[model samples]
Every structure is written in structure tokens, then in C-alpha cells.
Target: METQKINVAAILVVALTGIIVTVLAASLLMAYQRVPNYGYVKSVGVGVYWDQACTENVTSIDWGILEPGSNRTQVIWIKNTGNTQVVLNMTTGNWTTPEAENYISLTWNREGQILNANQSISATLTLSVSTTITETDIVEFSFDMIITGTEQES
Candidate 1:
């Protein structure tokens, strides 16, 4: 009877071990994978900087590496260099891959906000990569971000 009990114990252990391994494998298969992307920052009628002092000009934004279905945020300082109240607008262009527009999206925290002359505001830009982007063709991608400031007529 002791041998029979030992056999049952061994079977239970094996079953639990198999279950744990299966769960771990599944989690890994469903995990997020890294995808790299980048873009340039261009400002018109204003100054886009990395520092509050506006000493450092923001040239390019490197998202390092992005994970599918995830979002990466970059904070930038926009200082109104003009003498009048200006409204801020943002647009993207020069997409290396047209499909990138479908998989990637850019959004900012400041929308339709008027910036006063000599005033600075910190804005957060979010880059989102769609989970459904399984295309291996997009090994590298690039785009341009154009931030425009229009004078708000008094």
C-alpha cells in the first residue's frame, strides 16, 4: 500500500508541473515584442526645446524601441517666440512607409491651446503602436512632425 501511495503522489506532481509549464509558455507567446521607430521635430513661429531655458533645440525624437500595443511619451517645451498670442497645431508628414500611419499614431496633451508670447508650456506627445502590426517589412521607419503656431488675431 505504501508503493501505491507513492505512485499516486508522483502522478499528481507531474500533472501540476505540466500545467505550470504550459501557462508560462502561453504567457510568453502572447507577450509584447519590441519595434523601433523614429521621427523629426520641426517648429514654425515658435521654439521647440528640450529644456525650459530654451537653450537646447529639439532636433529629432528617438523612441528608442517601441513595443506593439504600447505607448511611449516624449515631453517637449514649446515657447512662443513671437510677439503675439499664437495657437498651436501639429501635423505629421514624410512617412517612409504609408502603412506606418495605420499602425502608428501621434497624440499630444495640449490641443488647441493658445500660447502667449514669451510663455512656455510643456507638452506630452504620445506614440502608439498598434498590436495588430505584424508586418516584418517595416524594419526601419521615419516621419516628420511639424508644429505650427498661428497668430491669434485680437
Candidate 2:
């Protein structure tokens, strides 16, 4: 009976220590700061809209406050306004600061997706900033997100 009591005490001590270590690790992980950035949005061959109706154009993307090594996603609609089927292509250019282009990247869920004429598709746009961006030279930047669509010839 006494041996069992000692074993129980040892297990309880180990569990309590483990819980304390876990709580401390979580607290440390949550003690980081967030960085902020912003950029402009534009479209070319296709319409980037906030609504499926394609009336509310997505003029800009506010990444808001961000953390290093973190990614932000925005959902928008792309409309094929041309008369023929088109494959959507997205590109970024005209960055306000050259360093911004090197540290920040833009991507979409759909790559080389074909859209029928007058059809709209919801797309998730992701903006990622490198965790190695230690340089404080850039707090904000602007860029043109040209979402061009290539016409598929029959």
C-alpha cells in the first residue's frame, strides 16, 4: 500500500511538471510582435471583384497587421468578361519599394484555371512575407496585381 502511494505521488509530480512546462512554452510562443503592410490591387484581362456580381471591384488588399512567416488570404471573384474562354494569369508589378518585392510574395489558389465567357469564380489570394525580413526599411508598399486572362483560340 505504501509503495503504491509513492508511485502515485511520483506520477502526479511528473504530470504537474509537464503541465507547467507546456503553459510556459505557450506563453513564450504568444509573446511575439506583429508587423504591418499594405498594397494596391488591379486587374487587366479579368475583373477582380469583391462581389460575385462583379460590380464591387477589388481596388486594394489590406493585409493589415501581420506576423513574420505568416500568410494572409483574401477571397475575391474573378470574372471572364471576354467573349471567348480564357485562362487566368496573375502578376504583380510596380512595387512602391524594391525591397517589398523581394520579401513579399503573392499567390492564388487557382493557377491556369480556365473560365468560360461571362463566368465568375471565387479565388483565394494569399500574401506571404518572409520571416527573414529583418530590415526595417519597409513598413508599407504598393503594387499592381494584374490578373490578365489569355484567350483560348479554337
Candidate 3:
């Protein structure tokens, strides 16, 4: 009777070991299942572009032989040669001749505007000389025009 009991205990241990090994093998196989990756992810690139001419600091307006009581209108062409729309802002530096400030007046048609891709806009600058200006007064003015562009949100 003792031999029969020992044999039954050994059989139970072997069965339990086999069950644990089979469960482990099944789990590993499932964890490493081979699946085809039919989908792929690609990255898109984005950038900002600006016109070459607009980026330069070259003079766009030149009024030669400015006379007293004369009004001159010069157009500065702002072009957007980029792939995205942009908001443009213009900044003017202080006049070179402070004495001429009162006698000379400056005005712009549009100081701020929106420019679309591959589009151009004109900014008319009107310079007026007051009648009080004398011939020998020699009113000389120089300033900078800075054009800044910011990309528009979609």
C-alpha cells in the first residue's frame, strides 16, 4: 500500500511540471507572434520662404531733386515668393535730419498688410515738403525701412 501511494505522488508532480512548461511555452509563442506591418509612418517637412529682393536692405524709394512745397509718391513693392501666407509689418527709423521733421511729412498707404504666397503688394510712400522750407535750408533726410514677415496660422 505504501508503494502505491508513492507512485501516485510522483505522477502528480510530473503532471504539474508538464502543465507549467506547456503554459510557459504557449505564453512565449503568443508574445512573439509574427504579424505583418502593413502600415508605415512618414514625416512631413515644413519651412518658411521669403522673396530675395524683399529681404535686402537696398533702397526702394529714391526721390531726387526734392523741392520745397513738392509732394512725391514712391511705391515700394513687397512681394511674397513663399509657399505660405505671411503678415507683413513695416518699421521706419528716425529721420536723419531732425530739423527737417516739421517741414517734411511722410505717409504710407498701408503700413501693415497680409500677403499671400506668390503675391505682391504696393506700399505708397508720400513725402511732402512744406512751403516754409527755404531753398538754402538744405533739408536732407535719411531713414531705414524694415519689412518684417510672420507666417500666418492655418
RMSD for all candidates, in order, please: 24.4, 24.1, 9.8
lDDT string, candidate 1, 75-138, tens digits: 9999998777889999889999988888888989777889987899999999998887766556
For candidate 3, give the lDDT: 0.68
Candidate ranking (TM-score, best to worst): 1, 2, 3
Candidate 2 lDDT over 30-121, as tens digits, reads 86778998974433367889998899999888889877788999999999876778888899999989788888899998789998878999
For candidate 2, the per-residue lDDT at 140 reads 80
The global C-alpha lDDT for each of the candidates, from Candidate 1 onward, is 0.87, 0.86, 0.68
TM-score of 1: 0.69
Q: Pick the candidate with the highest lDDT.
A: 1
**Candidate 2 local lDDT, residue 107:** 98
Please identify which of the two predictions, 1 or 3, would achieve the higher TM-score against the true structure. 1
The TM-score of predicted model 2 comes to: 0.68
Better of 1 and 2 by TM-score: 1
TM-score of 3: 0.49
Write model 3 residue lDDT over 23-127, tens digit each, in one string: 999988884557777864432212222333455434446777788899998766667656677777665567787677778777777655677777776677788
Which ranking of candidates, highest lDDT first? 1, 2, 3
After superposition, which runs of candidate 1 have C-alpha atoms over 4 Å from their true positions? Answer: 1-44
> Which candidate model has the greater lDDT, 1 or 2?
1
In model 1, where is the ten-residue run with the lowest total lDDT?
39-48
